[model samples]
Target chain A: MRFRTRRGIEVVAVADLSLDVADREFISIVGPSGCGKSTLLRVVAGLVRPTTGDVRLDGRRVEGPGADRGMVFQSYTLFPWLTVQGNVEFGLRIKGMAATERTRLAQDYIEMIGLRDFANHYPKELSGGMMQRVAIARALANDPEVLLMDEPFGALDAQTRIIMQELLVNLWQRTPKTIVFVTHDIDEALFLSDRVYIMTARPGQIKQVLNVALPRPRSLEVTTSPVFVDLKRTVLSSIREESLKAISLTGTE
Target chain B: MAESNTLRPIYRLGDDLRPHEPIPRSHYLIIAAASTLSLLALWAGLSYTGIVQPTYFLPTPGQVLATASRMLLDGTLAVNAWASIFVIVTGWAVATVMAVPLGILMGSFKFFEALFEPVVNFVRYLPVSAMIPLLILYIGLGVEEKVAVIFIGTFFQLILLVADVAAHVPKDLLDSAYTLGASRRRVVTRVLIPATLPGVMDNLRITIGWAWTYLIVAELVAADKGLGIMILESQRGLRTDRIFVGLVTIGLLGFCSDYIFKMVHRVALPWSPRIR
Candidate 1:
């Protein structure tokens, strides 16, 4: 009886939320503050266990965190003790890859990220933007099938975030992989995602899916275009409805 | 007289000391030196001019310096200083060996934390000085007793501090490591250890300083050697100057060890944000 009472009062974060991505597809989840978008991403990353469902990757169920899916967090999670090259080599080293091979491979990613000169510099010495760039490089070096990014540029200032977005788009174009990006920012989602899943308020379900038809080899200037503006307006209206619902729900709780 | 309107920026404290803003290093050094020199002058006047009128209890700075040199020449200072240093090093080493693993275990798992934290929290408050009588009765008054006192003094505190350092390794760090294919064991070795090593070094530095103080307390009763006993004997004969000498020697030793630890930290963990 006590258990049942607790269950009755429990706040559901996300429910009835099913999603899919094609191979090499780039999708984004956008919603209001408490709509459980990050929770949705965590569910996919296998960092959190879903109450009554499973996450399958290439037909194999993801029971826990693994090398096949790389995660980039909002906070720069690069190991402070490791250098840029060392950080990029982390996953390969864990797999017991030989030092010589991992070093060369890590160096390639470092060069691609424009951090070859700072390969030996510690994370503490780098600026926030540079640190986030290293985090991106570290995850991509493993060559995971899918990359899960949870508002990875949320901490960066506007200009740095724009530059990081361009860098990511260029990298994605060069080496296509399935990407699931989570952010509340409409423009960020519209700019990078092939498909955007706008979620409803608490007990989150998909409200709408917007297909971004923007051209590839995309620059920061695309955000100013009319097509991008229309998509942003649509996403903003959907997100505003969810935000109001979330606010009213909070007042009661 | 009014202060100069065109004073140097360093002298304009109203703006210079606003929260996180720091003064120039050279200016800081000069101010620190001036502060210490002024305090030394105050002490000199109070003792040398007999202002307090208790020369035996409050020896002049010159008198204490004379005793220091005399003791150094006779090698008595060196012998007792060495004795205290030995206990501190041995006891600290033993405690570190035991505490580090236990700390990591307690920090890593809830089971180990449940096993250790309550007992440690209870015992840490039971002062080591108060336990000296029991320690003396059980261990007898020898090197073992002194070392035990220092161990007891440091281990409980060290374990808790080390555990805290380990526990506070950010969740995202371990999360990122896991997603990058680190196994459970790999998380401990690669993520947890390196992430907590800098903090553990800081904890060691802090605990070693406390261990120095414990050595004096350990040597307080029935000890024939150590600077603590020298002070104890000096009190018996009212040789405050010699007591002052012993205190100065202990202070010097502590200062040197702390400086060495700092230098080692800088060299070993240059990546530490605290150092940067």
Candidate 2:
């Protein structure tokens, strides 16, 4: 679908793609910066409407924001004024859920993310990893069918990023919600996704979709495996080729 | 064993040092006593030698204190102070009630901001004291006129401050709330209001001081029952002691009110950045 911004710039993001994401597929869409992967996820979340395409979940056209899709942002977008528990209860409160039920639900998810001791703490008191966990817990507490994460761990240091990546993999393994993660990290895409879709830079189009044949319940150790290395090399080469093509067209390499 | 002898001097010097502890209440009493004594000594020295005029230009500190006590006994000081406080509070409350919602609206909506901001900026730059004659002509020399004076002065300042604060709420926070299924009203109340509260509190703290300045001006307009009226009356009669009393009372009240607002702000927004 093609979308034009208010600035008269055209965004031809998803063009003629016919891939069905199953009920709980963890798909990652990777490209260089400004490739509209985040925009595509936002479109799926119904935040921005496509000019000439349809986004449907279970054959129903998505309209406006709904409770069925939960989004976690890269910036750890927890309301600073609210305690961790309060932030998690925010979505439930909007649904007119009772206080006791909301508290119970928030507590369950807060505990699930191993933040029970820090439930009363505000977001500023948390480290980056803890804040992102709170953001994840907040998104999940609403019990959405699809979880949309836009570079959720892009801001953390390498060590914390690895830890959060593992935590996310564990969470997905246990709960198994359909996740569409957008990232510029090649290793991150290969490490966590069932299938990785690489896109061309700018006016982004899906260039290649590679299925990672890695076994489920993947661990950090799998990154060193020969198969994982081969997949990484292939994805890297595809992304490099696309970037080189972009440079040639723009003449700014 | 020979090196131990040299270390003994350092250890002895450190051993006499005591751990720091909070000052005891008795220490406050001693400090207060010392301050009063120093002030009394200075005043007595100035009065005995006639270094300054005692009655006309500079009243003796004793005379000012005596006048203040006499006014307190006659119940006039309390009444006047209360009247001034009532005017300030009513005017400030009305101004806040009008300013906050309007500011939030103008801050959130682009069209409203564009329409009202220029007008607000224009009117805000006009000296609030310049409107006194117009206010008196319109509302007469009554409590209503004084209130109008105070409201005009306080409202414009608060609106600009609150609107600026509201305009700066991070777009990511708004987007996050919206994506979480928050309606527009919900986003305003839950996210926008809370995010802008610290800034609003800061404006309130400033506006309270402005309210005091306006209260004095408001009382200067044909009123006979406030601290400002007392000062004017004393100046007319050349009662310098009573004038000093009024000035001291105004200064103390302004200081106390600002301090009280600071305390309340700190308590209300505990997570806000600590004030120095």
Please report the candidate that would top DockQ against the real structure: 1
What proportion of true contacts does candidate 2 retain? 0.47
Tens digits of lDDT, candidate 2, A3-85 = 77699987576665544688999999998676778888888888888776777888898886677888998876888888999
Q: Model 2 reaches what TM-score against the true structure?
A: 0.82
Candidate 1 lDDT:
0.89
DockQ of candidate 1 relative to the true structure: 0.88
lDDT tens string, model 1, A1-253?
Answer: 0011254876567888788889999999999887888887788888888877788888888899898999999987999889989999999999899999999999988998899999999999899999988898889988889999999999999999888998998888888989999997788899999999999988889999999999887788999999999999999999999899988978854
Q: Give the top-scoring candidate (lDDT).
A: 1
lDDT of 2 by residue, B108-132 (tens): 8898799889988899888877999
Model 1: number of backbone collisions: 0
Those runs of model 2 whose alpha carbons end farther than 4 Å from true positions after fitting are A1-20, A240-253, B1-74, B233-244, B266-276
Instruction: Name the 10 consecutive residues with the lowest summed lDDT in model 2 chain A.
Output: A11-20
